[model samples]
Target: MTTPTRPPKTRRRPEWLVPAGLIALSLVPIVAGSARLTQLTTGAAVTAENARFFDSPVPVVTHIVGSSVFLVLGALQFAPSLRRRRWHRIAGRIVAPAGLLSALPALWMTVFYDIPTAVSGPGLAAVRLVLGTTMAAAILVAFIAIRRGDVRTHSAWMTRAYAIGLAAGTQVFVFLPYTLLAGTPSPVVYTLLMTAGWAVNLVIAEVAIRRRARGPRRRTGTTVTAAGARLS
Candidate 1:
């Protein structure tokens, strides 16, 4: 008698893993921002860095609120289960506008405000301007793509926008430890850290998008193969 056939091994799809990771990775900025807001409201002893935010609070505050909402809500979109339900669409509505608001105010501040030399140099300023503009454009294009019923394009563009929006979160992880250990870094170091954050997020987003695109093609190939086997 032959031995019993083994059951087929299936790959487990951890769809929620990315979203969970995004939330966890973002906690640093979330906590820091909350503390700053509390301090600002309570008139606590503020440093020069904090005073800059108070000087031109509108754009800074707007960027903080909008980016926070976009990053937090956008993270939910990665959950496949939520995408099937009403959560995705509802979150999309908030995310799109919030992303635009976030990027626009940032661009405005970069263009018009006198950026503190201690915070950023010419290199970092230019990078932020370009990234801020691109993020805004990505959000707008994603909105148009969805309106035109191009779900794939919409998803790709939104992924890009979300990646840019999360750059701040990534930067926190990159520079916060160093800053704590050695105090504020030089402008060159700051620029490098900022660039690293953007690069890392964009690379990850591209990989995720490519993997998502391949999934449908893989399934179609499997279906066609099964049909051919049946005919044989």
Candidate 2:
């Protein structure tokens, strides 16, 4: 008898890619935030860039810490293997509260902080307000959805919330080319770049959400066809 040959096993996509990319994207902002936190805690030299943070430290500190937790811990939630285990729920609990802490303090600072007009003009302030509110609201909606056993809606809203929270990291990359070519952007240009960063993140989040929504249906269809073939 001829030896039977077994088909080669298909390689599964690495579950780490999504989370690793996200954490890498978050690194720049996290490092910057850490420096700021160290400055605040250790009473380091305060320059014009950091003076505002010193003036009202609470909101900025809360924002930095909360956002760091949200971004780093939240990234892990994207891993398929992690999501399949109990880690997802545990991370979600921490991530939701961290997101709220980040967004709410960000809104507070945006409204009340004595930010210079050059750094954050009225247009940028408005954008910050809207996105901050949206992030907070999205977290709340996701929490409610999960509580009601609506997993799909919960996942979609959490993805949106995470995108907004991660916008700062994206902003660094978005501004790099402009900063390099033009040598430090004007305030208007800065605002535009920031908006572009947030827009890019939100668009990507929507695409991912749609793809995830379609995934189950595709699997179900494949299984049904296979079953029919077997029966026939």
lDDT of each: 0.82, 0.88
Name the candidate that leads on TM-score.
2
Candidate 1 lDDT tens digits, 1-232: 9665433445866988888889877675667667767776788775766676666777777777787888788998999888889879988999999998889999988887766788786488889989999999998999999999998999999999999988878988878788899888888988998899899999999999998776533232133231223111
Every candidate's CA RMSD? 4.2, 4.0
Q: What does candidate 2's lDDT look like per residue over 1-232, in tens digits?
A: 9764543444667889989999999898799899888899899997877788999999998998899999999999999878889989998889999999999999999888888766764499999999999999999999999999999999999999999999988998898888888887788887899999999999999999998876632232133231223111
Please list all clashing residue pairs in model 1, or write none if there are none: none
Best by lDDT: 2
- Cα error of candidate 1 at position 104, Å: 1.4
Model 1: per-residue Cα lDDT at residue 187 = 84
- The TM-score values for the models, in the order shown, are 0.84, 0.88
TM-score of candidate 1 against the unseen true structure:
0.84
